[model samples]
Target chain A: MHLVGLQAENFRNFSTVQLSFAKHTNLITGSNGSGKSNLIELIYYALFSRSFKTSEDMNLLHWKESYLRTQIEFQRDGVDKTVVVSFNSNKEKKVLLNNIPEKFSVLFRESSVIVFSPSTSQLVKGLPSVRRKWLDRILVRVDREFTSILYSYQQTLRNRNALIKRKLIQKEDYDLYDLLTTNLVSLSSLIRKGRQDLIKMINAVISPTVSKMDLPMFSSIELKYYHSRMMEDPSLLAKEEIKRGGTLIGAHLDQIEIFHGDASVRDFSSEGEQKLISFCLKLCEFDLIQVKTKNSPVCLIDDLFSELDEDRAQLLFKYVSSVSQTIFTDLTGRLIEADKVIPLTREENTICLP
Target chain B: MYEFTPSYLKAVEELHQLPGIGPKSAEKLAASFLKMKQEDFHGFVEALQELREKVKQCSRCYNLAESELCLICSDPERDQTKLCVVEESKDLVAIEKTGAYNGLYHVLQGVLKPIEGIQSNKIRLKELFHRLQHESFQEIILATNFNYEGELTAMYIVKELKNSSLTISRLASGLPMGSDIEFADQLTLKNAFRGREKFSEEMI
Candidate 1:
C-alpha cells in the first residue's frame, strides 16, 4: 500500500495543509518545532483515528481552534481509498472510510502501518508490559484472532483481579475462583502461544537484518521468549495467585529478553548498538507485516536519522527505500535521498509534492 | 426557533426521559402524536398509563407481568428442573423467541457492577438465592450476556450456588449461524474456536 495524498485542518500547529506523497520515498525536513512530527501524526491519526504522541484527542487540536480534521487518500490492492478523521472540543470524534462511518477495528484492518520514532527504543529497554503491548499490536495485525484472544484475556484478568480485591472468599467463591483461573490459564496460554510464534518470526530476521547493517560491535542478536509461570503447574500458580491477592502468572508477566551472546542487550549494549537493534526490530516488523498481509506497510520514520551514525543512517535509508513507500523526517535533507522533499516552516504551512 | 405549546413541550420533555430518546426524537414523537386522531392519541395515553399501573414483577421469576407469575413461569410445560438465569426480561424474550430453550427463566433485572455501586444484594440476587434453596433444580444455565458485568454476575451466582448439587453452565458464545468465516470478526472467530465441538462418526 502507498499513501497518495494527505490534508489537515486545525490540526496541531498547522491551520491547514495539503500534500501528495511519492510511491517510493518522501522526505520531510524542518527545524525544531516546525510541525514535522505533527505531519506524520496526522497520517497516523487518519489511519488509526488516534494520535501516537498523546492519548488525549484535544491536544491534537490547534490552540483556539474548536476541532481538528484530517483526510488521507491511499491505494491498496489497486483500489483507491480515502479516510477522514475529525474531532472537536466537545470530545466527539468521527472516523469515516470512503465517506462511511467506520469502526476503529475496521480502520485497522484496512490499513497497515509500521512507525519508528525516537521514543520507540523503549521497546528494547522499557518494561515488560511495553514489550507485551508491542508484541500484541503486531500479533493483532498478523493474526486477526489475536485481538479477540487478547481482549478476552484482559477481561478475564480484570474480573479475576476484582474478585481477588473483594478480600472475602466464601466456600462457594472457590468454584468461581477455579473457573476464573481456568479461563485465565487458557487465555494466557493462547496469548503466550501467539507471542511465541511472533517472536520466532522476529528472531528469524533480527540476526540477518542486523548483520546486513554491518555494525561491527554486534555479531549476533537473539530474542528469547520468557514463558509465564502459568505454563507450569497452573494449580500451584493459582494458589500463589490467591495468596498474593492478585494474578501472579499470565501473559501480563511474560517478557521477550533480547540478548547478544551471553549478555543481555538492554543491560550491556552501547547506545549505538541499542539504536541499531531497535531499527532492526522495526525492519523485522515491516517484513512480518508484509509477509502476513502480502502488502508492504507504509513506513513512517520520525527523526530517525538524528540518532544514527552516517553508515547506519545510509543502511536504514537503503532498507526503507526498498519498501513500497516511506515517509521520514530529518533535521536536514543533506544525507537523505527522496522522491519528494517537503520543507515545513512555521510561517508558511504550504506543502509541495515534489 | 419556533415555540411549541406548553403541553407539547411537556410531552416532548417526558418522552425524552426514555432511554436513547433524545430531545429531537422526543419532539418528533410529540408532533407525530399530535397528528394522530384524537381517539388514537387517547388510546396511546391510556396504554402508557396502564403500563406503569398494571405491570407488576412476577413473584416467581421477577420478570414483568400482569399477574403473580410471568407467562413463562406459569406455563406448565416448561422444564422447571432446568432454570436459565438472565440479566433482564428483554433477554428472556430474546431467548424465548429462539424456540431453542424450553427451561424456565429467572430475571436478575441487572448485573453486578461494583464500580457503579451495584453489588450482589443490589439486584434480585437475594430472591435468587432463596428460590434456589427452596426449589429443586437439576441444572442451572447462566444465560447472561457475554460481557464484563454480565459475566461477573453469572460468576457471582455460580459462587453462591457452589455447594448445591445442580450442574451449572454458561450460555455458549460463538459465531452466529450463517456467518461466513471470512467475514466474521476476530472475537466471533475466537469464540467459535473456543466452542468448537468434537466430531464423531455416527453413520458416516
Candidate 2:
C-alpha cells in the first residue's frame, strides 16, 4: 500500500494544506519551521488515528481553532482507499474509512506505517522501559490478541498490588491472593512468549535489512528479552511484595536489550551506530507489518537526514524507497532524485505539488 | 437572558438528577411535560410515585420487589435446590429474560472493589452465606460479570465455601453465539479454546 495524496485543515500550524505523493519516492522540502514535519504528522494521524508527537488530541488543533481534520488517500492492491479523521474540542473522534464510519483501531487493520524520527534513536539510547514499550506497541499491530493479553496482565498486576498494599493478609484472603497470583503468572507467561516470538521475528528480518544497508558492524545484531523473574518462586517474593506494597516480578518490569556481536548497543555503541540500528529496527518493523497485514506499509521518515552522514542518508533513502513508498522530510532539499517534491514556505497555508 | 418559570426550572432540575439525563435533555423533557394532557401527566406522576413508594428490596434475595419476597423467590415453579448469584438486581433480570435458568437468584448488590474501598462487607456476601447455611441448596452458580472485581468476588465466595458439599460453578464466558470465529477477539478466542466442550458429552 502507498499514500497517494493527503489534505489537512486547522491542524497545528497548517490552516489548510493539500498535496499528492508519488508511488516510490516523495521528498517534502521546506526551511526551518515551514510545517514540513507537520505534513508528515497529518498523514501519520490519518493512518494511525493518533499523533506520535502529542498524546493529547487537543494539541493537534490549530491555535484559535476548535477542531482539526485530515484526509488521506492511499492505494492498496490496485484499489484506492480514503481515510478521513476529525477531532473536535469536545474530545470526540470520528474516523471514516472508504467513506464509511469505523473505529480508530480499524486503521491498524486496514493500513500500517513504520515511523523513523530523531526520537526513534531512543530505543537504543534510552531506558529499558522505552524499548519494552516499543516492543508492546509493535506487537499490538502484528498480533491481534496481544492487546487483550497485555491488558489482562496489567489489570491482574494492579489488582495483586492493591491486595498486597492492604498490609495484613487475613486468613481467608490467602485463596484470593493465590488465585490472583495464578492468573498473573499465566498472563505473564503469555506476554513473555509473545515478546520472545516477536524478537525472534525481528532478529530474522534485522540481519537481512542490516546487510542490505551494508552495515558490517551490525551484521550480527540481535534483540534479547529478559523476564523480570521466574514465576516458579512467586511464593518466595510474597513477603517482599507485602513489604514493598506492590508487585516486584512480572512482565511489567521486563527488559529488552539490543546487541551487536555480544556487545550491548545501548552501552557500547556510538551515536551513529545507534541511529543506524534504530533505522534497521524500523525497517524490520516495516517488513513485519507488511508480511503480517499483507500490505506494504508507507514509511514515514521525519527529520532523520541531519543525524546521519550524507552517504548513509542516500543509502537509507534508496533502500527504503525501493521496498515501500517512502515520504521523507528534508531541510535543504538535498535528495534531488526523488520522484516528487512538495516545497513549503513559511506562513504558506497551501502546498502546491511540483 | 430569558428565564424559565420557577416550576419549569424545578422540573428540569429534577429530571437532570436522574441517570443519563443531561441538562439539555432535562429541559426538553420538562418542556414536553407542559404539552402533556392533564390526565396523561397525572398518570405519569402517579406511576413515578408508585414506583418510589411500592418498590422494595426482596427480604430473601435483595432483588427488587413489592412484597417481602421477590416474584422469583415466591414462585413455586423455580428450582429450590439451585441458586444463581449475581452482582445486581439488573443482572438477575437479564438472566430471567433468557428463560434458560429455572433456579432462584441471590443479588450481591455490588462486587468486591478494594481499590474503591468496597470490601466484602459493603455488598451482600454475608447475607448470601447466611442464606446458604439456612436454606438447603444442591448447587450455587456464580453468575458475576467477567471482569476483575467480579471474578475476584466469585473466587472469594468459592474459597469461603471450600468445605461445603454443594456444587459451585461459574458462568462460561467466550465467543457469543453465531459470531464468526475469525472476528472473535483474542481473549474471547483464548477462553473459547480453553472452555471447549466435549462432543461426546453434547451428543449424549
Best by TM-score: 2
Error of 2 at A173 (Å): 6.6
Q: Per-residue lDDT tens digits of candidate 1, residues A40-123?
A: 888999889988889999888888999988899999999999999989999998989999998777787888898888877887
At residue B9, give the lDDT of candidate 2.
Answer: 92
**Model 2, runs deviating above 4 Å:** A77-81, A98-102, A161-178, A230-245, A352-354, B112-119, B147-163, B174-204
- CA lDDT, every model vs. true structure: 0.83, 0.85
Error of 2 at A352 (Å): 6.1
Model 1 lDDT tens row, B1-204: 889899989999999999999999999998898799999989988998999999999999999999999888899998889889999999999998999999888999998764454566668888988888888788999998888778768877877777889899998888887878998866777778998877869635
Model 1 stretches with alpha carbons more than 4 Å out: A164-166, A169-178, A227-249, A350-354, B1-16, B23-45, B112-119, B129-133, B148-178, B186-204
Worst 10 residues of 1 chain A by lDDT: A167-176
Q: Estimate, for each residue in A208-253, the C-alpha lDDT of model 2 and write its tens digit.
A: 8887777866879999998887655656678788888888877878
Could you tell me how far off, in angstroms, the CA of residue B42 lies in candidate 2 after the best superposition?
A: 2.0
Interface DockQ of candidate 2: 0.47
* DockQ of candidate 1, scored on C-alphas against the true complex (2 decimals): 0.30
